[model samples]
Target: MDHRFVGTAELVETPSVAVVVDVMRAFTVAAWVFARGAEKIVLAGSLDEALAWKACRPDWMTLKDGPPAPGFDLVNSPGLLRSADLGGRTVVQKTTAGTVGALAVKEASLVLCAAFVVAEATAEALRTCESDSVTFVVTGEHGQAEEDLACAQYIARRSTEPETDAAEFLRRAARSRAATELEQGLRQGSHPDDGALCVELDRFPFAMVASLEGPLMVLRPCPTPSSTGAART
Candidate 1:
């Protein structure tokens, strides 16, 4: 299998499977929300789009950039989701990296949102789906965020090598520019707990796959496939 990595939305040609990683938050937050029982998540490319979604579906929780809006249930913070009751609820999410990258990959046959929380499951999905080539899209903050790149590299490595030192990878990613920024934000009393949650590796075991449901990019969780004991590369 051919595995490649690209920063931001730099993919020129689409691959059989596209794994989008946004470790600092985005995908990490989504995984946690799904684990907490969110029925579905809709990815919006911009804040305006997310608001439009909320306008149509008043029951859905909308999360955009900056602080949480007056009526919004939550912000794009992974730590906050841990305490939220999202059972059977639909969420509209718009982030700086993850959602933007997902929207940019219009040519992918399959799109999956990933973070360290669901890295193994994501890799197994690619293998189970018989994808010959996979592209890891590192949705870096603005330019290139180290946390996203680390998560992307980890997923790529896991696709070929089953045994991975996940702890070591998380440790390295925690020192990334994005992670550092979150840490600084925490110190400033801005989403203080989010920094820790964003770096929590392997927090969820299921992978979130994106499917086009009408005009929305709906994310649904899929159980990770068990190892088939076949040689993978």
Candidate 2:
């Protein structure tokens, strides 16, 4: 399979498969939410859309970044997701990068949201997919979001070689601007453990695949083709 890496939501084109990555938080948070048993996540294009969805579906939960929006159930923080009782609940999510990137890929036969947390599982799923080409949509602008770029590269590499070393990619992510901001947030007692949660490679053994359900882009977890062993801390 041919693996292509593109950046931001704007440059995405129709590919057989597209892996939208946002390692700083969005997709990583989604992975954790699913791990906590969220039934599915509906991707909203903006805060207004997410809020509108919430207004109609009072039983559904909403997650977004930054200050808590009115009626939002949680911030886009994996730490918060860990403690939330999302068992079988539906989630409506809006983010600066991840969700937008994912929702932008309208023509791909398969769309998968990824981050370091589910990198190995995503790659394993790609190996079994019957697509001739794969595209890694780096939600961060081209060459701008270092962590997302690193995660995309890592996913591509791991797809071809299961045992590829990830230390260097992890190092790059740790030293990125996003990581610095996350560390600052940690010191401020806001989303303190999220940084740690986002970097736990291969933490989940399933791929987060997006499918358009009516007017919404809903993400659901599909188990990987094979177990990639225990997650790395």
Candidate 3:
């Protein structure tokens, strides 16, 4: 298997398998939503698109950042979603990086949304699927989003080397620019424990796979293959 890393929407070329990662929040939030029993998450390219989609399906819930948009059931914050019970509910998610990056890679045979929370499971899934080449899309910036990049590297390493420990990678994520900002936000009570929430390595035991269903990029959880053993938390 060939493992490599790319960045954001513009830089990602179609690979055999693509793991779109947004560790600071996006994919982390997705993992939490899935764990909370969300049926699926529809990835939208823009806030307007998300709202329009939600309007068409009144039962579908919307998750996105506020201030710029008005009709969302939840913000793109993992801390707020910690206790949410989204049993069988479908969520339409629009984010600045994560969803955009995911929608850009629809050409790939397999597209998995990833974060440290689901890193090991993602790697195990890749191995089980027998993918030839996998690209990690760090959906923060081209090269500056160290938190996302660190997660990509960790997943890549885990996919290839089964026995690797995530301690060092977690350390790197903590020192990233995004992590620093979230820490400051935590102290100010702006985001409140969101940084701590984002870095909870192996918090979820399944990989979120993005499938193109007509015009929607819907995400569903792919539990780690049972034969690959349990994911560490």
- Identify the leading candidate in terms of TM-score: 2
Clashing pairs in 2: none
lDDT of 2 by residue, 35-70 (tens): 787899999998889889988989899988887767
**How far out, in Å, is residue 11 in model 2?**
1.9
Query: What overall lDDT goes with each candidate model?
Result: 0.77, 0.83, 0.83
**Candidate 3 local lDDT, 4-54, one digit each (tens):** 777764563578788999987889989888878889999998888889988
User: How high is each candidate's TM-score?
Assistant: 0.90, 0.92, 0.92
| By lDDT: ranked, best first | 2, 3, 1
Candidate 3 regions exceeding 4 Å error are 9-12, 66-69, 186-190, 227-233
Tens digits of lDDT, candidate 1, 128-148: 778778888888865367787
- Predicted structure 3: lDDT: 0.83
Query: Model 1's lDDT to the true fold?
Result: 0.77
Which RMSD values do the candidates have, in order? 4.5, 2.4, 2.6
Worst 10 residues of 3 by lDDT: 224-233
Off by over 4 Å in 1: 186-190, 227-233
